[model samples]
Target: MSDASLHNVTHENEAQFGDYFALLKPRVMTLVVFTAFVGLLAAPVSVHPFVGFTAILFIALGGGASGALNMWYDADIDAVMRRTKKRPIPAGKVTADEAKAFGIALSGISVVMLGLATNWYAAGLLAFTIFFYVVIYTMWLKRWTPQNIVIGGAAGAFPPMIGWLAATGSMSIEAVLMFTLIFMWTPPHFWALALFMRNDYDDAEVPMLTVTHGRRATRNHILGYTVLLAVLAIATGFTSIGGIFYLTVAIVLNAQFLWGAIKIWRRDEDASEVDNFVVERKFFKLSLLYLFAHFGAILLEAGLTRYGIEVL
Candidate 1:
C-alpha cells in the first residue's frame, strides 16, 4: 500500500521463490529426474513427449520437496554435520518455517500434478516416496536406528519404478528388479561415507552404523552388501531391460566395486587411526559414480534398442 511496505513485500516474494525452489533439492532432483527419464524412455510402451516431460518434472519436484522436508526437520543435525551444514535451512538461506511450508506445498502440488499428467498409480508412489523419506527415513529411522539407510534406501530407489509406472500405468518385473538393484546398493554406498564421516554422525547423536556397531562391523557390512549388490547387479543382465551394453557395464562396474569393497574389507578401519578412513571416503565417491554410470549404460542400451541395433 505504501513505498516501504511495497519494497518489503517484493523482497519477501523473492525469498519465497528461492526457498520454494530450494525445497526441490535440485542436485538430488537431477539424479531422480535423469534416472526416471531413462526408465520412462526404456520401457516397452511409448509415452507422449509432453506426458513424459511432465512426469519427470513432478517426480523431480517430489524429490526436491522431500529434501526440503529433510532439511527442515534435520536443521539441528544439518547445522552440526559438515556434509549437511550448507543446506538451505541450516545455512540460513531459508528459515525453518519457510522451508517447512515450502516443502509441504510442493509435496502436495507435485503429487497432484503428477496424477493429472500421468496416472494415479505413479502419483501414489510419489506420495509414498515423499512420506517415507520425510517421515520414516529422515525423522524416525535416521535418529533411532543404525539400520536407517538399510531400510530407508527404499525412498531413493523408487524413482525408476515411478517412471516405469508413469509410462505404462503398471509395474513390471523389470521395474522391480531395477528397484532391487538400487535397494541393495544403498546401504553399502552410504555406510562407506559413514565410515569416513563417523564424527558427523557421532556429533549429531545419530546411531549410524559407524557409531553404533563400530568401524570393523561397518566395513564387514559394506563387504556383505557389496556381495549382494554384485549378485543383483549382474543378475539384472538376464532381465528384459538387460542388453549387451547393460551386461558389460554391470560386469565392469561390479568388478571395480568388488575390488573397492575388498580393499575396505581387508583393511582395518580402527587399526590405523581415524584418519586412515580416507580410503573409505574415496570409495564412497566411487559408489556414487557406480550408480550413475550403471544407469547411463542402461540409457545407451535403450538408445541402441530404439534404433533396432539389437545388441542383446
Candidate 2:
C-alpha cells in the first residue's frame, strides 16, 4: 500500500483502540464500580474474592459501554457542548460510526460475559441499563422534555442493583433501597451541574433544565429534588443493611445538603451576585462526595458486620 493508505490504516487501528476505552467511559465507570462493590459487600451473601472482582469489572465495563453508546449517538450535541466537545468522537479521535460499533460490541460482550460469570438476571439488568441509558436517556428524553434528568436519573442508578443480583442472583428490598439512594440522588446532583453549566447546554441546544425551564425554574426544581433526595437518604438508613455509621452519615450529609438546597432555593437568580453560582457549585461538588461517602458507609457497615461487630 501507498504511504497515505498505510497511514490511514494505522490511524484507524489506533482510533479503534481509543474508541474501545472511550466506550468504557472511565470516570462514570469508577462510580459504577464503586457502588457495585458497596452493594456486593452489603449483601447478606458473599462471593469469592476473584469472582467479586470479575463481577465488578464486568459491571464497570457495561457502564462504560452505555456511556460510549451515549456519546456515539449524541456526538452532534457533544461537538457543540464545551464540556463534551473534547470527547473521543467529537474531538476527531474516533468517528461516530467507530464509536457506535465499539459501544455495541462491548455492550454485547459485557452483558453475555456477566451472565456466564454470574447469572442471567444480572446480565439482563446490565442489558436494560445499557438500553435505558443509550436509547431512553440519550436518544429520547434528552431533547424531548425539561424533565429529562428527573426521568433519565434511572439510568445512573442501576449499578448497585446489578451488584446485588450478582451476589444473590436475585433482587431484595435492601438492594432496591440501594438502587433508590442513587436513583433519587441523580436529579439533584445533575441539576446542580446543570445550574452552573447552563452555557454549555445553551450552546449545544441540549434541552437541559437550566436552558429549557429557565435558571429560576431549574433552581426550584433542584431544591424540590433535593428535598426528595434528603427524604430518601434518611429513610434508607432505617432499612435492613444500614447501620449506625450509615445512618449517622446519612443524617449529617443530608442536613448539609438540605442547607445547600435551601440556599439555592432562596437565592434570587436574577441577582448578579456570584453567590448563586458559588452555593450551587459547592452543593454540586458536595453531591459527589455525598454519594461516595454514603456508599462508603454502607461498605463500612458490611465490613463491621462481617467481623462479628454490629453498628445497629
Candidate 3:
C-alpha cells in the first residue's frame, strides 16, 4: 500500500477502537465502579479480594452495557443534542444495530459473571439496572416526561446496593442509605446541567425540566430537591455505615451544596445569561465533587471500622 493510504488505514483503525470504547460511556462507568467498590468494602461481610474485583468489573460492564443500549436507542436525539452530537453512534462511527448487539452481549456476560463471582441476587440487581436504564428510562421516560431523571435515577442508584448485596448476599439499611444518597442527588445534579444546557435539550426535544417547566420553575425544583438531598445525605452519616468522618464530610458538603442550590434558585435567567450560567456550571461541577467526596469518606469510614479504628 502507498504510505498515505497506510497512514489513513491506521488512523481509521485507531479511531474505530476509540469510538467503540466511547459507546460504553467510560466516565459514567467510573462512578459505577467506585460506588460499587465502596459498597462492597463497606458491607459488614468480608469478600475475597479477587472475588470483589471481578464483581466490580462485572458491575461496571453492566453499567457500560446500559450506556451502549441507551445510545443505540437515543441516537436520533443524541445526534441533535449539542452535548451528545459526537457520541459514537450519533457521529456515525458505529451503527445502531452494532451497538444494540454489543449492549445485549455485555449485559448477559456481566450478569452471568457477577452471579458466578458473587450471588444471583447481585446479578439480578445488575440485570434490573440495565433493563431500567435501557428500556424504562431511555426508551420510555426520557422522551415521555419531564420527570425522567427523577424516576430513572434508580438505575444508577442500584450499583452500590448491588455491591452491598454482592458482599453480604443480603440487604441492609446501610446499603439502602447509600442507594438513597445517589437517588436523591441525581435530579439536582442533572437539573444543574439542564439549567446550563437548556438549549441542547430544547434542540433535542427531550422533555427535561428546564424545557418543560420554565427556568424559574426548574430553579425552584433544584432548591427543593437539594434540600431533600441535604437532609438525606446528612442523616445517612448517622447510620451504621457512617461515623464522625462521614458525618463531618456530609455536613460540610451538604452545606456547600445547599448554598449553591440557593444561589441557583435566586438567580434570574438574565443574570445567568450575563455570566454565561457561571453559577449553574459551578454547581454542576461541585455536584460531581460532592458525590465523590461523600463516597470517599464512606470508604474511609469503612476502612477504619474494619481496622477497629473507631472514627467516632
What TM-score would each prediction reach against the true structure? 0.92, 0.94, 0.95
Of 1 and 3, the candidate ahead on TM-score is: 3
User: Residue-wise lDDT of candidate 3 within 187-306, one digit each (tens)?
Assistant: 999999999887899998888998898889999999999999999998998888888998999999999999999999999999999999999999999999999999999999999989
Candidate 1: lDDT of 287? 90
TM-score winner among the candidates? 3
Q: How far is candidate 3 from the true structure (C-alpha RMSD, Å)?
A: 3.1
Q: How well is each residue in 1-312 modelled by candidate 2, as lDDT tens digits?
A: 798877675454456565568656888989999999988888888799988898899999889988888988888998888888878877787878877887898899999988998899999999999999999998999988877887888888899999999999989998988888888888888888887776888887878878877878877887888888888888887887888998999999999999998888888765525555788889999999999999999898889888889543
* Stretches > 4 Å off in candidate 3: 1-15
Candidate 1 off by > 4 Å: 1-20, 270-276
lDDT of each: 0.87, 0.86, 0.94
Which candidate order results from sorting by lDDT in descending order? Answer: 3, 1, 2
Candidate 1 positional error at 270, Å: 5.5
C-alpha RMSD of candidate 1:
2.8
Runs off by more than 4 Å, candidate 2: 1-4, 8-19, 270-276
Question: Which 10 successive residues of model 2 have the least lDDT summed?
Answer: 10-19
